[model samples]
Target: MQGAQRNSLRLLQWMMAASLALPIALFVFASTISYTSTNDIADREIERTLDVAHEHALKVFETIDRSLAEINEVVRGLPDDAIRAREPALHQRLKRLTDSLPQLKSAWIFDADGRSLVNSLVSPPPEQGFADRDYFLAHVDHSIGTFIGTPLTPRPPYQGARFFGVSRRRDSDDGRFIGVIQASVLPEYFESFYARIGSDPGSFFAIGRTDGTVLAHFPRLDRDLRLDPTGPVGQKIAAHPDHGLMTIDWASDGIERRIGYRRVAEYPIYVSAGLETSAIRARWYATIGQHLVFGVPATALLFLLLAFAFRRTQHLQAEAAARREAEEALKHSQRLEALGQLTGGVAHDFNNLLTVIRASVDLLNRPQLTEERRQRYVTAIADAVARAAKLTSQLLAFARRQTLKPEVFDVGERIRSLHDMLATLLGSAIEIAIRLPAEPCLVNADAGQFETALINMATNARDAMQGKGRITFAVQVATTVPDTLTHLVGSHGFVSVAVSDTGIGIPAARLGRIFEPFFTTKQVGHGTGLGLSQVFGFARQSGGEVTVMSEVGQGSTFSLYLPRVPPDLLPQRQAPNTAPALAGSGMSVLVVEDNIELANFAADGLTELGYSITLVDNATDALAELVVDADRFDVVFSDVVMPGMTGLDLAHAIGDRGIGVPVVLTTGYSEALAQEGRLGFELVQKPYSIEELSQVLYRAARLRRVRDGAAE
Candidate 1:
């Protein structure tokens, strides 16, 4: 009986082991297969999304191109006499052109003299003259076929809204240039086109000029928004022009997104489409969850059977614990990634605000005033700008977008000059130490930004110590890492600057994210979460790297490794200077600006400087004024943005009208309008102080005078 009982016990144990082992092994195998299948599904979904985006983008480009091509064909076929006749036949032809292609808002022909010959939307005898339009001159070259023109406010004050023109040369039957034909498309056309590309509220599309000026966006967001792609993923997209997809936190919408971007390889413009990652990943989660639901019950059944036979629940429990740990880790990583995106978005907006403030302050300083009052205003402006400067420095540092203005400089000398400032910044509660090498170290970097970075790091160190601890900054040149320091050395040729502090060391959980933007332990108002990010950015931008070492009780050290600057390239030093005095003989000028206050100010300022001034509210009035005295004005000074006719069109009209006057274009936001090497005239960016205005006017007048003298 005892032998039989023992045999039964052994058989039961064997059965229990098999039950536990078989299902779990099967579950793992099934799970692995499921995961691989899910991965493949995700990849296919991404590719499909990309394809849809690419197709939509290409359609927009083709639509614009085809619309322009149709207008060009009509223009080439029409005779100058027929277009110039200003009869019902001409109006009918123009209307037919627009009717056939609804995308075209209006179409018109301009005679060689810059006068509107035939317009689709206007009465046959249209009163407007094109003698001063940029498009007229831009198309005159003929080499630039089917080009996009700057945004144009329509001609004749009460007639049209803002539109962009697509122009091609109008050639006679004999191939002689008789005139130019243009198709003006409204902003609504682009808005509608972008709208069709993406319907998801979370997905947005933007059509921007090459210089980053956004022309149109679907679900139009704020006009003030700017996109900077200097971050790791942004850099990758820019460097690789091929279509690609990635999950990134979009700072603009404050959402994690799986963005797919493709450069319109055929068009001069850059357009991109972005979709929310949540939307794309939601499907994957649902599918995975369904599988998990079915598998979990089966898994539980297997465990129960094993428990009944073998009494070994501990092994099963251990495996569950391990899976939970992995899931937690993945969630944490996702959170950090989200936080980095938020930081970048905040930084971009902050930088734009700083730019506006800085430009305003710079303008304020150019006028003459009483010494005491001027000194106060200057100091106040400087102080405010200094704070703004800190934000920009941090942005550049974190984004690695800081423009390098490198020159040879003695790093040691620069640091020594900041000793007094450091002492005040550190305060009496904190002890400070500096270790420098005996030899001078030269570095190539932007000095102002470099100084600001050092000060920021020092301030952070002071805060870490809670205003009462020791901080040491050591700078040295070493051939190799000493055996004493195995924990913080890397393989590279470097000059090291180590800032160590005896304060609360970073928690192990947060250590990995210490350099991420906006990952802060400080109270809301106390930090922007950009300090260390900026430090990391600056180091990388300066051809260096940063690393941190910390232990809970042992404190922490932040080390920056900067590559030594080559001897051939050193920093340049500049002496203080003032703007050169305006130098040119007085000449007649036309000032076209919509803002009454600004227009009056500009006209008065120009008149005071002894230049003859003609002022107008829009391109129509400017053309009328010029017709009255076409040869009187030496230059046309106009604002780029206006209610009816933009400054660019006004410039083109000036050229078209057979007036040889030069143009000095001005704008508050000229990025969208100004095309480098194509304007055929000068540009003065707005909110301009008297001095800048005078200088630009002077340059324009001088150039015109020289040209006239050559003609003589």
Candidate 2:
């Protein structure tokens, strides 16, 4: 009788376990179906909304362009004087034309010189000229088809209107460029329409020129907003200029979105529509939540049954916990692997540079070397030093940790000066073109790093073109940085230096990783892959950004945007100094460095430059020496990183103790210097030439003397 009872209990326990498993398995199956179907429905809805936006953009732009074409034909053979003679009639005609089209805010006719001849907004249009405007300049230079320019606020007398130019080039009978005929397309029209159709929460709609300039957007961004050409939406347009779909984290609002984009047919414009991923996920959650409501009660009942078989349930729960822990450990291991890969690449390149230097040194040690042989070894060593210095600078720039010395200067002048240098760098096979606006574009940044960034980009262009295509450098003024550059969205304005190449374009798949350090597509030994990385870091560090646009077979354009400084901020230009190279005469320098070899090298170099040098191993010893006879040294030249208190600390200590000597800090790399900057002291970067060292020391020493003389 007891054995029978035991068998019955075992059967009941098995029945309970089966029941628990059955409900959980059914719940999992139901959830999988619900989640998949929910995502599908969301995707379809997003695509449907995108289709509507695309069609709306097409109709609006087509209507505007068609009207402009009709106006072009009306004044086809009329000269500027003839158009002016009939100004009243022409203005009335334009006003009527604009009134007929809800898309157009106004219309204007400009002469060859861009003087407003007739406008729909006002009769005998205001005495304003648009000669400097992008739309006018674009048509004046070339006979491109319909051109849609970036958004701009109308000047006085029409300042209330917000419009972008939709222009067509006017040509005379002889094909000479006459002037521009432009329609002032109201962005508000597009915005209103977008809002009506884009009713979903977190939906986005944008109309932009092919060049990534935002002409209009829904949810209304600043009028000056632009799009990053290297971002996901831009890449989609580049890869599929006609139409495409993409999933990306939208930088404008920091939302992940599923987007669809289409180009306005035969026009330099594109339109995009997107739905937020978060919103889509919410729908999925809602659908799944409904299932959970029913499944939860069933699950609770199953748990109660499992309590009768608590031993089996405990074993399963422990296994699940172990699985979770293993997953976490694996994720940590993967992160370490990624770190190791980056470090390994850095180590490899550094080792190669070091090997070259080591080999050159070993060869130079041979006794009684011939002049030719000795010169070759010395040249090799010099080459290695230069390459190493460049490598170090690139690394620092990529990390955005380089100490920058910023000054307000004209970027156009700098580019003009680099013509000869760029010519030499790109070689004879490549043709170079430069386009500079009449007005100077100025920015405050480290001029040397600016030049380096330009050179790096040009070099990349040259390589992409296989050393034989035209590279154009164009400088333009921009009112706002791209909104997709999340970090720089609120920047007041920017000056864009664009480098374009007629070379093999970058692949869309590769564009996202192009700025990562040591990520390269070039064959081994052909490139270091840090060129773009350096450009990226330098722009960000300088309060700006760099963006790229590339179509697989149609070449590429890389643009560097820097914070613009007004012309008023430019420092007065001083006459060039004609002083002799030995300019450090009579200045005494206290060299503070922990490394004996480096200290001796600097001391000897400064001494050769006509400066008297006193050497010390650390800041403490240098302070001791300075405390003894403060007037003995004109300047203290110190290495920033040292064994004890850093060089920066010493500079502070010197100032705190009333040491009148000026401190000039030097370093190859220092986190503190990069973060806090020069700290009111002169700074010279490492691997600097003797001439550079002399100039900095002399300037600091002379400044000190002048201050001391004033006190006396």
Candidate 3:
């Protein structure tokens, strides 16, 4: 009887071990399948989103091209004799052309002398000469059938309406040039398309110029919320054009977002869409939770039944628990990664604010400060600001929150400008030599921030040199080496800016963490430990890489590898024009601002500057005031972002009521308002001193005078 009992127990133990092992194995298999399926689905969804965005952008370009073609056909309809005579028949033909196309806001003919022969709209004669305009000059050589002009805000009197003109040379049957017929399209035509994109409530889309200026956005939010594409992420995109999607912690939104960006293949613009990753993961989490609720109980019951049958099941149970723990560890690692990104974002924003304050305080110390008492106050304020700036910089570097504005500039010129300052900044113990090409050795970088990065690197080099050593700075076009070859395949371009110092070189072990924030080798109070980190951030933000080469006794070299901007596509430099003076005395102005302090300050400043001011806190009150006496105010000075009604809506209202009062918009934010393209009014930026307000007022007054003179 004893032998039979032992045999039964042995059989049961074997059965129990198999029971526990089977379910755990199945659970692992299920999880693997789920993860793989989910990953594939996510990738497909991302691709689809990118494809849709690309299609939408292409449509916009096509529409603009078609409109230009239509304008060309209209210009060809004008008779050669009518063009030469500049007769009423020509005016009628232009009017008919504009009337037929709703998209064409206004059409006009300008003679070779820049005289407006005929205009679709009434009231103004050709007093302002267009001969000096870029469009006019561009047409002198390429007077083709349809020449598309660059985007520009039309001058005042037209209230700075943003329009791109399409000009065509009028020719006779003999193919001789007669005159030019131009059609101008209002910015509204392009803006209307953005509205139709149907934006998600929490998500926003922005189209920005290459320089970080926003062109358009859906569900218009605060202008201050506009993302600077020239910031760090933007530089990354420019440097690695093929990096289709990236997840970045965006400080403005206080969240990590999966950003999808694509450069418009045919234009100098970029389109980016961001979706909050947390929001996306929330749905995934809910789905997983439901699965686990069912999975956990079923899994537990199977294990419990197996334990009753088997005494040897403990070992198998341990293995299953280990696998689950490993999976949890992987999840925890992902969470930590996300946390690091969040910290970095916070640091970037804090640093930007600090930089602004530091620059402002520095400006206060200029000789422009005349009074001794005022200067003393400014100095005290500067001291406080400097301390605050230092604290924020430390926080930023620790969090890795530095964004950059990158541009292509001559490295030689950039260094020479700071030569004198560097000598003063560093003692005579350190010798600095700059070796640069005579011709412009251009590297894509932000001039201001690049200077700061260079200074930080130089300071580090000086410190390492122990107050006596030579530092050499060199600029050159990048060349590929076998071991250090970059992944920028098919590209024949790059620029390298290098700084080398004969100092105590970094040890091999410490070199890797040198770019990390708050990682310093110096004693306390000697450094904030942000110097190298700032250089790293600056390099990354400029869409480049920062690399270090060091040896114990041979010293160290730091190289910043940046992309090069093509020569033909470089930004054009336009000569500055003096601000025109106000042409009227005793002109009454209506000031609208939501901020009471700002409004009152503006009113006081304008009143002192010779204009009578009527101040209102909102657009509604301003409109009510206007209705009471529409003719009282000569111009409406309003803020764009307000509580009830926006400045643009107010301007539209005034236009509908036939109030010919000119509108002057004032805002601290320029991106959104600028994108609106000359809302038929002049715009002045906020935080303006009294002098700037006076100048803008003067310009508005002068514009009215010019318009009135033309009317007479």
Candidate 4:
């Protein structure tokens, strides 16, 4: 009887073990299958999305290209001047054609110089020129058929609207390039369609130029983005050319995805679509979670297993949260450290300059100072002040806050002009090589800043080479900027001035931080570390960018990209206005500045310049004076930033109240000035020399008189 009871107990135990083991095995197998199936589904969906995006992009481009062709035919054999002369009829005709196409926002006819000969948007096209525009530049030298350009915000009165250009090159009877017939395609049209088809939040669709310029994206990116040709998707496209598939972490947003891409026929355009990896994994989890409900039979056992899983999930989520917090803290600390470094560097340099000025001032004030000694002290003081100003200027450049004076100039010529100077600076040990295109590479930018940027790059290269390596400067027209500099690339093209050095290369670890202000690898006092920062800022401020490539032993190359100016537009380059700082000719001026010292300084300077000055410390007080006798002051010179009413407000109020005094505004730095620009008022930046102030005042007073004379 005891043996039978023992046998029964063993059988029951075996059955219980079998029950748990069988279900656990089934759950594992089911989960594996579900995960694999989910991935397969995701892959199929991505390919489908890619097909849809590809087809949609192709149709849109084909339609627009057809419309562009029709417009091109109409304007065929007609010179830009003739089209400009017949703008009225041509504009209406272009408008009708553009209106018929849902994908098009507008159409434009540009001369070889990028002048908007006529556009469908407005009558007379707002008197604006597009000589520096990318689409115009692209079609200028190259005869790429049905060229598609990246998205760009249209200039006011359509400022807030975004459009991409589809342009065809126009040629004269002699086969010389004349201009372009471009259709302004609305990117929103494509984006909206993509959103409708790919509604999943993880779904991404994009249309880009083969060269990597993003024309449109489904998940509307806040800023322009580009795909790196070196990245997985770009490589896939390069390999397949027509169609390809890959799983990659997209460089643009750092999202891992199962993606597919296709080229739009023979055009230089590509369409891509993808589903996020995380989303696919989530779908798999949900599927397996459902399967878990049926896999477990015993309620108590299932409850316990779920509880364990729930705890594990909670622990994992907590760990992820902690990691995220740690990362945020690290980033915040890094930012603070960078701030400290920048401030310390600036303070150190400024203090040194201040020390020189202070010592010079003390010596100048000394009793019985010799005439020669006094002059020497004054010169020292002046030199220190100048150095201080230069330091401030460099800081502003790195911050991209300095006002720029941009002009059109041939970059090739400028480099040629700087050859002797650069050779001298680099020393005889360094061999300098200049490589330029046969044609001139013209760009519109601050020539001084451009020169400074080049000098900074050369100086950096010299240091890397230990002042004894070959430095080659090359200038060429670039169709696309590097992916890192996508934001700065123009839709038309860029003029790349690459400075290459055969020297010890920058390490990968420090490459990204090279542009940070005051960040350097040099020994103490060797480098201020603002050279690369200045180059970065100047490039960005000039609507371009700087990119670097390096390998440990191979050396480094730094490329500064500036938007190209068409050679045909060279004649339109405005000559430097060197207005003589003549006497103000007794013109009455109303000066408005809150700072007492600045107000007095301006008053003294203007008085010396033969202007009768009425000084008011605030805009309100200045307004009160202006209201009393609007015609008494020939011009109102006011600082933009002040207590109570701002200079901008005061100027508006004066204009609203019919004050005749022409308002000239000034500021050290104001966001309003930086963003909205002069707002139709003449603006003079602060720290202006007396000569500059005099010239501005004289110009203002003379302009007011001319207006008054015309009114009379």
Candidate 5:
């Protein structure tokens, strides 16, 4: 009886472990995936956000180009004498032109001698001719197109303002040296407009000549300021004068920024929209934080579940030690039965995780995981685990025993939102069409399971089509149930999400058993045969049913029919947590363990991973160390089963005194520690390999970072 009970427990434990590890492992991989994809999303977001500024700058320059063209046309027709005779008329025209474009500070015509013939603000031209001005000198020497000059002090009637010139050189019919047409634009106007684009203090916008002359800028400085035209950014703009986007080293402020730039079609001016490097990555860091919050606990808990399952066997083995050992043949027979019961995707994913975990652990054994990679994988696994858990909720979910988290959602809108992801997922070879209704078809279901089913269906379609074809997702309302939808028995007023693919159709004979567990027509390791079953299970659980319509050599359509909710019901969306990353930047750790070997292992791992470590033999010594210098370490890593005041006691003592550093306790098995319960410290189980050691250390370090951040 004892032997049979032990064997049964082993079988059950392995089954539970298989259930636990697969989901968490899947999440770790998803988290690993975010390392590449989220950064890609962040890059795309940066471009999209900066484009707002780009469009604004583009419009500003276009306005300048038009003003330049109109001024040139007027100056070209009227020679110096023509303007002198109708000076009042020309000033009125110039004033009207300035009124049309707010960026223009003043508009005027200057002769070859650089004396203003007529000015927009003053009817009589200012005596201060711009002969010394760069634009005036360049036109005199016969420059053409547009010359964007350095900002100048506002002369005479426009005394309080500063202005930059957009001037064009006009000549006689025979091309003799003539006067220059100029529009002096207010940088403040552009600055005020750019302010509407973003409120982040560090994000600034600028438009300048390709030669590096600042035409306009935001955060309006009261004093005169002009950037070095030949500086790093100026040279970059010069190199790609037509238009470009790049990372630039700002010469004036020396701050690095990611810039999106484009040259105004008909002007020498180039517009640049830029955000600081930190500002651009702010979203990406938030994405990472959201992933870590869920992922870390999931990864750690996954290990704990496996530990629970295994430790039961260990406990039984200790009790059975005094009794006769089980026969190898019997043990082999039990494993085979368990193996047969849990084959396909669950096992496959479990194996994949072990492989990755083993690889990561081996690296830790070598103690070579750098701080960045260490933090990434740790956070990734934690984040990814959550999704993986949702993916594998098959058995009890299908049995209808599990509670449904039914929320009303629009099938049509959901399908539309998935367009980009579906495109990227299917790749270029496969075309994806999202056929969503103008009206939303609301349904009640667990959003995660619903999404998972759709993803699985898409994956199945991809494999069936051999990765090259069209996959269409369509949503519609079904007013009546059909005789063929017997499995969906009571579903009424249904909303359907139909996924159709132009792939080789499923054989009629195989269709009947397609939803059965472990049944697959594909080669080993390719199809788990759980895809259709999940769809079927999810449909039934959501008070709906799945329908399959296919023909040989023709495409296949799998429709998920879910009961429709009233139009009055609102849909829910999950917002990602945008928190700062828990960064471990050379924090000191206190390692307390009774065992010399374990203490050495902990200290060595922490030290090699770039953390300063102080090791003590017992919790007594740990308390002394902390009492002597409370601020000595950022995190305290203690062994729970230590002699003379356990790690829990040290934690409680720390809590009482409010020593403040986060306590991390490592253990193998302790009834006492478990009973102590909720020590307000992180738990890391013992007999840890290098991989396990690193995970706990990362946890401690992460907690310390969080604590320190709160303090700050």
Candidate 6:
């Protein structure tokens, strides 16, 4: 019966999986067909574009030939000595030719020696010589025939002007070559025409000489129109001579192009049209992408419905089982809740008394006390502080009011930095070994809480070892998380940290309750039993997990798993410096607090740091002082909660007045501050040491400079 049930489950899973896979397989097949068809269509597009270019190029050459014939007839019909005898008539005819053909620049008649005899311009002819010109040489060599020459640059404003020339060799009655009749062809006319030819921005047309000197190209400026016959585009052109269609990257921009070209057999000119490969591919892919956008989801939905229909009965059974498990979990949670209720009340009451003891101890450990008494008192106070820290950590587990200031940092680097401090805390009696991966395993969490959790786990390992064994901390990445911690670590990725200790491990029975608040295996006075509980609370709060595995004789391993944060998203870490602090340089500070003692303490600290201070007890008084003398203070240090108005309200009021004074808000977890979670002004957490205050003061001053736009 069990085997049959297992087989049935397997069959159902296979059916569900097949239903899911079918749509994906269909999509893959459809995508292949779509892409192949798109590519074929793209090739047809390129061919059609090339055909248009070819027709344009044919018209260009035919127009040039027809224009050459017209000029030749006009020149031949005139008298042999017409230039000298009737220069105006010859010039008028030349001008007429230029007027009819906009591409035609100007016409000139050159003497046998190639000096300008007559030109189309009415103005005086400049003393120009074109004896060395290619058109002049070509015409002189060809008797009684018109010839086309390579493109050349004329003088300004036509200087560096790319134009071809048609020259008809003037022959005497004996058929001897006389001075050439030349007409300049401006390639700009072809360029402008080609610019209007295609819709694709990347597609371009070009007219080049047989030797590969470009006469003109549209959609780009190519001053040096020379193409290297050795290059990819040049070689591709060379390989396909008559009417070629090939793909190659043009050297100018190195963009792959599907080029169609036609070699002008009647002349040295050739025309090329290049369609960008990327543009063609984009058109192809966009069609397929559009199909996938609508088709894929529809296909997936159909398969999903089929799978769900088939699995409905099994899903109902699973839901019934889950409800039963949830009831059992609720009862188990009630028992844990009862235990936590008693523990929480005791921890909360003890916290208040411990705060008084901590304050009294701080006042007692002064210079007035003898060195011997001070040492004894400090040691006793340190022990009590440790105990109090443990008790508070345990109470924090049940407290929903704890707000985390989460930041992303490398867990490996952070742990490595804590090495020296952990060593001092653990002492030389125990060995500490650190093993970290090559790269940082970044995680997002409150850095202070993370370090505290590490210390707590280390402290437990030390006690378990009787203060004399090795502890190892290893950092790595976890591909999968356990079911117990699935919700905490989440799905993106995670950093795994293993804290192993070579110590006398806990018995299996006691291991289950180790993370419970105040559940200690040690005797009274040894521990408050909150170390592991704090670690558990910290891990859960940080959107991570903490778990333990122990063997009685062997050792124990506590693993902390944190969700990985990308390096780019990691927040900047700022820590206070312990070096000689920067003094305030006679700056003025306004200290505001509802409590007189706290205000005085803050004022004294600023004064000692070389800042002059004015104290105000409450936001109402501070505002009154500021309104009276706004320029007196360089910085404002205000406590968050005040009787009349909060510091946030005061800051807003200051903004309204446009006083532009920098305000720093201090708070010790009040409902006012806690509700907002973060303050508008620069913040320094409460109960901060003098060093931390100094650093924050510097930051506040820097922020003031920035706000005032006076930053250097």
Top TM-score hit? 4
Candidates' TM-scores?
0.35, 0.51, 0.37, 0.53, 0.39, 0.45
Error of 1 at 675 (Å): 19
Candidate 1 per-residue C-alpha lDDT over 535-566 given as tens digits, one digit per residue, 9 for 90 to 100: 88877777677778888877788877666565
- lDDT of each residue in 643-669, candidate 6, tens digit only: 779888888888888886888887654
Q: Provide the overall lDDT of each model, using Cα atoms, as 2-decimal numbers.
A: 0.68, 0.84, 0.65, 0.83, 0.73, 0.75
| Candidates sorted by TM-score, best first | 4, 2, 6, 5, 3, 1
Q: Which ten residues in a row have the lowest lDDT in candidate 1?
A: 669-678
Worst 10 residues of 2 by lDDT: 571-580
Q: In candidate 4, residue 453 scores what lDDT?
A: 92
lDDT winner between 5 and 6, please give it. Answer: 6
Mind giving the per-residue lDDT tens digits that candidate 4 earns over 1-712?
A: 3465456545555555666777778788888888888888888888888887888887888888888888888889886678778899998998898788888888998887777888887877766678777778887786888777778988766754698888889888888898888888888888889889988869888888888988888678878888788876677777888887788887678888887888889888888888888988989888887776666546457556655655565566567668879988999999898889988998888888899999999898899999999999889987887777766667778888866767789898899989999999999999999998998788988788899899999999999999898999999998768776677555557899999999999999999999988888898678788889999988877878899999998899999988887677672354354555679778999999888998999999889889999998888889899778887889999999997899999999999998888999988767666556577888787677777888887888899889989999
lDDT tens digits, residues 165-254, model 2? 889999999999999999988888888888999887778888888777888787787647767888776777778778877888766666
Number of backbone-clashing residue pairs for each candidate, in the order shown? 17, 0, 5, 3, 7, 0
Worst 10 residues of 5 by lDDT: 575-584
Q: Give the TM-score of candidate 1.
A: 0.35
lDDT accuracy of residue 265 in candidate 2? 74
| Candidate 6, run of 10 with poorest lDDT | 394-403
Model 3 misses residue 707 by how many Å? 9.8
Residue 432, model 1: Cα distance from true site in angstroms? 2.8
> All candidates: CA RMSD in angstroms?
47.9, 40.9, 48.4, 43.5, 38.7, 25.9
